[model samples]
Target: MTEIPAFKKNLPTQIAVLGGGSWATAIIKILSENNVKIKWWLRRKSDVDFIKKYNHNPSYLTDAPLNPRKVRAYHKMHDALNGVEYVILAVPAAFIPDALKNLNRNHFAGKKIVSAIKGMIPEENMLVTDWMEKVFGVPQNMLAAIAGPCHAEEVALEKQSYLTIASPNLQVAQDYANLMSCRYIQANPIGDLYGVEYCAVIKNIIAMACGITHGLGYGDNFQAVMVSNAMQEIKRFLDIVYPDPYRDLHSSGYLGDLLVTAYSQFSRNRTFGNMIGRGYSVKSAQIEMNMVAEGYYAVKSIHQVNKQYDVSMPIIDAVYNILYEKAIPANEIMTLRTFLK
Candidate 1:
């Protein structure tokens, strides 16, 4: 674990948390523990109204408290971001474009931007931080990403969880880390911005792969082998794409995050993959879950991005082939098993 830095206490007094999902509500719950006020932006006016009147999300994490006194819900992006000093984006990666469509670069001028999003921008194959910089003109130094073995469900339970705050600026990472730290959560900082984000994105795909195998009735023995190999695949991809000698793939930021996402019941990617393995069509599984799997989109993005480098990513290939190429999951996994050992 990297030691938490000693910096001037400069926590933002007000923050804008975008998105109306379970993750967004859980973050509002965390921030509600502190003195800082939160301006939460939900896409639907009904959901926003529900939070205001009932002090809890109507769709997700309804059991979690919202505390109307510290948290104010908004339907408009402009109203949510009006006077905030920091912005924490928690929406699904696929909806990010529409979420911020009404705003421009000027909207994020001096605010510290943190991505609670784990998946990359689809089609563009860009990390959220990179996309934010290019589209919103937010500087790299002002940006940070949150990676976790932590799940929103677990956070709502106040279960002990840890998060990695990655940024180009150590102090900036530390600053957000301090804000995110609470009794149930321990936030740490690292400077390997790209490495952390890429691993986070890759892990979802791995989790999907794990789910597919489990749904096929594969035993724990086989699942163990797949996850171990998945870690190696992540290391190779990260080493080639964003080389950092000091980055530890085994740390909580990398391997730990992957493990939880791959195995946890709360992982939507894993749940999505399981449905696929159980013979649900892609569209059907998506409709049943009614939540973004992330891996469903990320597989294609990573596949396209990996075309240039051509890393030996068998697990990723198996997922892409099954999800995109319409390859049989059983056949894909059988072939994938041969390459694992």
Candidate 2:
């Protein structure tokens, strides 16, 4: 973690953080260590002032300190994007449309955009890439995403982590593969954007199932079985959606994420699932967790897409009912329906 091997090649001139959340703040901390200057956006001037004085964000990741010198806090999103060559979007999946509606004031022609957020879009049932293309009109060449076991809490501790940068555009993905590929954070660049998105979406769903297992006192062996089958379902959908273009979904971004999300203490999705498995209603889980679980978001969206694409994603269905219905828990998601059949 001393010298960034990736920085030896080239550095992005300026970085823009599009959200004021912990993930955005944590990334700003990482990029700042390389001496990269950043313009960060928070919705309120109060946040900008709080970050300036405290250096510690009280809302999320309070233990992590953002370098005041390296980060210029801005009151507006457009102001944050000013003079930035790269935009790191860390907003939640649900907030993207409205977030971008505010961002649409300025036109970004060539700036590289990277989505650090994971989960499916709710109303449109679209992935971030789909939204980016439809709303921002980002050319296929300019968009890239980071997915895998990258967690904001771990990144704050400078944990040695690995993730993949994927896009149809090789050069753009490589650019991020280059920036984020440091000793602590290893980057694997892949060319299949759809595969990466599906992996990101489905992992959240499986993590919820993992939570269910944990809550039920099913233990790790049951988790091992669920995750193994979860990957099988992910691969099946990926085969039909991406066909031959992408490699097996078991690569770190897909299965790797599933394992981490299922087991990690930081996974809100798993925690929420545990609550559900313990007989807490989905509404109660959401209220108690406070933090958004990407799995809860993915359940319905994944089910919708599965039906349309003629691919069966059963884990997603189980989670959807657990969250959205009064289905008896003893009978619902009893086991691997697809595999057992």
Candidate 3:
């Protein structure tokens, strides 16, 4: 058991981000707006120089320039964690296993760790919080998940966005909500850790459904239907993982997020789905988007877990066929709709 360090007197409000990517840069902009200090740790010196010179990430978020004066970039993770009260992980879900490989779990030191990255590991099929607990021995009470419809592209533009900060601990949720609250960003504290994570995973599949519908030349009617059905499937799946997730189930966070993600032009998950619908292979869609379409990763993970628990997630199954089984997005839907109907 690692003992948490007592905060030193007069330490500034510092949040350390563990990955250097578009979402990280966007959140830094949002956090800076709240007058909080941010230290972003990256693996590359080029990113450091890019932000230092251009006030933006050239690789990930060139369109949304970061103000170098407002945020500091660090090369070493250790330097970033020093004196930081809260830590946010912003890397891709696939990279998490490797990210945790070198991190000093003790350095977390029982700090409030929030997962801004939303996806499940392929092998373990574990949510970010579950992965953290297994690998780092972090407690659920200290873990927070940021999930909702806000996009990095929109957040960078300083648009009005709402999200939920959730954990089993209400104070933990509130602490993140308070820390993340800003002029352009509104955050609501939520209590269901299961619902928050489930929403984060399921929205991508809904986005996939949207992409296929768009490719098939359908209008809002298809989107409306997809969103409704997707939520029902997510609720069913969550019921299997947590038999009583309905106790705190709120569509505002889950369904609202699904709605925006499925329709938003900036959604990588939806765009990735579009590519699959347009005959691009999954590998190629990944290439075109550059960012991990979390739903793509979750398709396999959720499928494996669903089988383990005998939980039926038709939307996840449709996405799995399109992404992994190389089924056309529209054809995949047709294949599933018959049995589902």
Runs with alpha carbons beyond 4 Å of true place in candidate 1: 1-12
Predictions in order: lDDT: 0.92, 0.79, 0.80
State residue 284's C-alpha deviation in candidate 2, in Å: 1.8
Clashes of each: 0, 0, 0
The most accurate candidate by TM-score is 1
RMSD of each: 3.9, 4.2, 3.5
Q: Clashing residue pairs, candidate 1?
A: none
Residues 74-140, candidate 1, lDDT per residue (tens digit)?
9889988988888999999988987888899889999999999988898789999999999999999
* Candidate 3 structure quality by residue, lDDT tens digits, 1-341: 97656764434578898888778877887777665678888879888877777777877767886656568888877888888888999988888888768776798876888988778877888888888888888888899999877888888778999988888899989978887888889999988887778778878877987897677666887567767777778877777787663444555577778878888988888898888777788888788787788888887888888887776677778878777777766777777666443
Error of 1 at 243 (Å): 0.2
Model 2: runs farther than 4 Å from truth?
1-12, 335-341
